[model samples]
Target: MEGFQIIRWLSSDDTAAVYEAAGPRGRRLIYTVGHRPAEPAAEFSAWAERLRGVRHPHLAAVAAAGLTDDARPYVLCDTGSTTLAERLVHTPPGVNEVVRTTTAIADALDTAHAAGLRHGTVCPSTVVYAADGTPQLTGFDMCAPALVKTARPGLYTAPEADPGPPADVYALAATAYVALGGTLPYVGDPTDPALRLRGITELPGVPPELTGMLRTALNPDPVSRPSAALLRDALSTVEVPETVTTGALPVAVVGSDVRAVSSGMTTIIEAVTGEQPRIGREKSPPMPPGLAPTRPLPVAPPAPKPVRAKPVTSKPAKASGRRTGRRIGVAVVVLAVIAAGIGGVWLWRDQFAEATEGSSAIERVDFNAIEFTVPADNDRKVTLTGGSATSTNDDGRAESWTLTDGPVFADGNHNGDQDTAAIHLVLEVRGSKRSYVLLFTWDGRPKQAQQVVNGVCDVTDMRSAGPGIELDLVSANPFADCSALGKGDTRAETITVAMRGGFLMETAPHEGATSRCELAPGAETRAQDGDLPVRVAADAGAPELAEDIDSVTVFLPETAGQIQWHLARVTLADGTTTCGWVAAADL
Candidate 1:
């Protein structure tokens, strides 16, 4: 309502609140805000600036974004009546609708991606239908945390694994899978970090014609996925080939030109992001510990007070009548006991359900507390340099590492070639707990590792990521020559480099960047380190919101300091404090 005319409140999540409104041009648009408090000022500016650079028919236009006098961040965009998500919930779309929607979105994605942009989160909800049934996408240029706030987790690809076209294609194809198959691409629980472990293994049951297209888009390596234009163009023709045209960007033709475009886009992205390019997932900064959800949690209802039995009275006249009274009293007691048992069961079920759904189910990864690695190849003929090193955190804190001893090289099976890698391991460590690792591999030539995980240079932790590690074997191995197409000739059986200990995340502090927090239910009340109760949503149902709350019970996992992660929060009586298992995800 700042400058637009409000029509009605539409919907909201922990990260944003949406409303229908009339723009200054008399056209309609959706207004969204980082409604949660203590959001980063820098992040808002970055998201807004990127939004300004994007324009497409399929993409919902960003009409406006800015800070209010109170410093609330808001964004206004084109609105649509029914999102693919909402529509599917009521009735699944026909094949024709699915094709048309996917085509339009691909065209939009191609335009944005070619210009070096990505709709970090592309799911059914973002693609809404207009009054005329035309589809348009909202929530462009959203960051990781915001996307997590809005998106259905486990549906989107983890960016740390594969950024760029590959990840975007996977999301689009996944959306198509949901639209056509009436379910997500991967059927298991979306919250489980290990859910999509195999990476598009068993393709979703789709038309025989569309299978190859989806597979190509869903390749584990970004380098292998076809461009949005290529895939969309291939799908348009009635006669599609097993392999489409322009598979590898014609590394021959667009080689230099592609690099130029990618380079410029990279420069702009780096400037705005101030972090390495996360492959697929959105990166949300962590909120301070103990803050109430910017979005309120569903507080537990007051415990049903036990009903006390009424006292029996003795005012008998005859002996027979007294015997009858005793029998009647026993029946009353039995009936009361049954009623109490039923009430207890009902209360337990209500509390159990509330404790598992919505933000109550989400887990937060603390980026600050974890450590990561920065690896490099000691190019001195099989030498791996920067093995053991120490780096400073954003707050000028120090992190130490145990690196591979100097000249760490193993002999290769092929002609005594040195076997080593030019990878900088950026690991996120949580004490002795498992650490998340990303491999930064550079060989002065484009390769799979860079395409797969964006070389993992900037992230302290990846979005929706569980515990795992990656290695960029392009530079370190001595067996393979510096050929663009032929590297890493040393097969794993050839040799191995010994290492001690593990990794953590870090980046040199930005000059002007200030710290920011994630979306909170309210002014944050950091829960003390212990048990925090939150609801975990099932794979099918919508996560419910809290209508009212007396107080909140936050269940934080041991990963609190590792990834700025937070589980969903649960509401309880104002003074109620306790812990117990209500729901769980398949780890």
Candidate 2:
């Protein structure tokens, strides 16, 4: 009799026995007692023959199969030291590991599908990892039907549905769900695949990056599920970045698979890449520039997402014109799908935004003018009431404010470039719901909050600084004197400031409009140089000016160029400051 030693029984059920055994050659093997399907498919025998010859790193290799003396069929397959289910019982896999495993399983299944085979049964318990952690799938032709006593419904789809490709995807998602969330997706009838799907809906959510894919995979209707490869791709896209720059608007979909939510973005994306965002069954490849939706997506019906046969080791190649046209067609589908579906980049974005930004509300409003009043110069209490113009609050509330004077151009405390103008808003913020109009500068720094107060005169403007952005409330209306101008003195003012390249150089607040350069050095009105000679300017009239270069550096020693200030605000390397109007005809 051929002899092999049975070292130990690993697990057992009425239908099968898993044992650790040493072969006659002394090679270790996993021996199972079941081969005859309890309810085999029509092609069971042929499929078994094919599976026996097919080999893959992720699938267990069939060592041998035979009929025992008791007339029970048995199959022996190569396996790792432990199964995924066994290891997870003792220690939980981190979310990253779960992602890796999910990708590996998908790759294997996709490979199997290409070979005209399906896992039929894919679950955590059926996948064993080598001592080196490479997963080997064991259940292929072994997938039990409704009549089979040995099957894990907690990790599989219903047998009644034949649990096709999407079923395997569902199982992989369930496994990922358990790993990342640290809990089973469903707990009730572990044998009923239908009930399990229902239970999945009630379980705690997975990591957001995976939530949408899992939800779709877990759908009871197989038609609703995305393929395993697409599920893998979805998971791959969901990494929470370590850091995001401050003040950057939520532009790209922070963590989602959808390229864009609005149709407008699709146009921009197509214009940039000459390709559109593909959606539904065949989503287009990523455009050259990475644009993603910021919304959380739901289980979208299968869009023809391209399945990669080889591992995604390199960046995707640029789309061909043919592919681009196909992508454009897919984009057209996206607009239609978006209407029918309640998910994708927008949903993911909303979920993520809520998480990162919380429910705090701070809004911005830009108006020509807003006027606030302070009864006393030192009085912190203020009231906003001035001219009549219209605007809308963040909450879409109708409000009005007026500009009593010009938008003044001042560097304030020398924080911003003096060339950038600041406005003097003197209009009454008129929203009954808004008792006080919160004032913030162009950069969103709270300038001054306008409120109500009365009592004294000589009102002075003030500013406050904090760890974050500073706040300032510039005063608009100025009076001649208490005796000359008493209470309710109405002043008509128009605000305009001359700005060069967004910098407020000077503000003609007195004229109630912005005009001219404020730095005219009264003595003779000239120009000088700054410490660093980055720029140069010249008088409108200088002989041979037409022949001179557009701009040049005089400090470089031999040039026709410009000036910064008439005052010695800029010192040279020799510790001497330079002033101007020397009037070099050509230098």
Candidate 3:
């Protein structure tokens, strides 16, 4: 209500009302105003401070929190308009959806608990999905505990006076129950203090393993309930039906971007551009830490977000502050402009063809109308009409290539000109997919693009590499079966691809790699001597180490760190050699 253009009331509770509002720049946001709080302004502000301090990918970050003009506490969170509650009304989540949502929220709760703050509230209404399909936990209330209990009792299945971590666990389990097409056992009014969640009702075809885990989490005894971390791990093991996971569900939104309507849910939010609602906008940076909204909003209109000269194609570096929330996703208008500038005019004689070399900034080009020729494959040419192209092979099997993402700008030729853009495409043949990167230059008309590289297994990340493009190529494990690659039996190596002499070339993306313990290549180290372990990758979550390894030989240019995980030639007891990642401490 403070200079924001209110669109409509979304949902409300006894303590506060939530509204869908467009901020000064016409960006949609979730605004909550609390009408009643057991504590005064100072207590509410302190609670908001705690929320601001904790940051996680799965947490719906608080952008602003302070008291309203009428002394009511208000909070503004960056989240998608749709809620889990609204989604359930339209799409009953499949087993995969249930597991993923449960695991993400549980991990989020565990992270919050580790920070010494209790969410104190976890419900369907509080969980939101970002544009990228990442689930986030929101609805951290500033209301006092007693007031929450008297107002929204269904949120907590446990009878604890002060809901803590255990209470959060129980609530997540209950929410999962509802998400898995199982209705809660509430008989009457959900807010009635006398009403209690008796037990979960099992849905037909739902896995007993999942139901059993929820039951354990829904245990009445706070001591008996599984911790959020444990619940997350347990859910990860449950089997999901493949058919259910692959089916599409109707998406709901609160704006004019609705694309389709069905029986249960009215509309789905498809942004003006095809992009989904991003996690955070560059305009809404996190408020300064320790600067609580104690002071009233300025009499004049709030300052508008700074303008950018060009649309950002890569994730920006996170800003530093006490409250560090990641600002992600490029704006819809920027994407729209890129699409309109490129997608709308791909003909050779379009307006972009008239611009001189230094006339103005080069409009970003989309690859939909661009023709790509694979130089190495007998000069095979494939023309993309609308981001996709299909042709029959020699054996009459249909092969297709679709442009998934891109037009990321880089000076591929390194000629001090930003004329080159990298486009990512997916090639599907016989139900198998391979990622390929195409380099195109817009001189006057669309220049002939080259299909530079194809992933032997899969390409994970692609970003600008100064005057080139860097990609993380994952190679499948040689010892494993063909399906093992899909199951993540792979290793990562960063490589840079650049345009040299009008041809794409590959080079080492980065320099200056040194091993921990100051070891050089060919150095020998005894491993597995005393419970030492080796993994598939440098990260801890990589596959667990094999048990038969006897010793390791240091490899050159290991990942740099004080105690880094180094790539080494792992020698097994049988005297065979294979490469793996080992930590410096183990050596």
Tens-place lDDT per residue, model 2, 404-467, is 3322222322332221122333322331211112222323222331111111121112111110
Candidate 1, 43-62: lDDT as tens digits: 66665666667788887777
Off by over 4 Å in 3: 1-14, 22-27, 35-39, 67-72, 142-152, 155-161, 186-202, 245-384, 388-587
Q: List candidate 1 segments past 4 Å from native.
A: 1-3, 10-12, 24-26, 36-43, 144-152, 158-164, 182-185, 191-207, 238-587
- Candidates 1 and 3 compared by TM-score, better number: 3
Best by TM-score: 3
Better of 1 and 2 by TM-score: 1
RMSD of each: 29.3, 29.3, 23.8
Q: So what's the TM-score on candidate 2? A: 0.36
Q: How many collisions per candidate?
A: 76, 46, 0
Question: lDDT by residue for model 3 over 1-587, one digit each (tens)?
Answer: 23343333333345554444434322345666654542566876676667678889998776676665555676676654345654554334566887888899999998888877776667665677764668888756533332232323443345565678998898888778766666556534445434454767667667888999998898767899999999989988888774452222222211112111110111122221233332112222222233322122212111111211121111001110110001111010011112112222354423344532322133334457666553223225677877899965445667787887676565443444565566777767666665566555555544543122322354544555445565544444221222333322333334455543332334331111111122322444444542456554444544544446667655433223344555555555543334555656656
The better candidate by lDDT, 2 or 3, is 3
lDDT per model, in order? 0.36, 0.35, 0.49
Q: Which ten residues in a row have the lowest lDDT in candidate 2?
A: 327-336
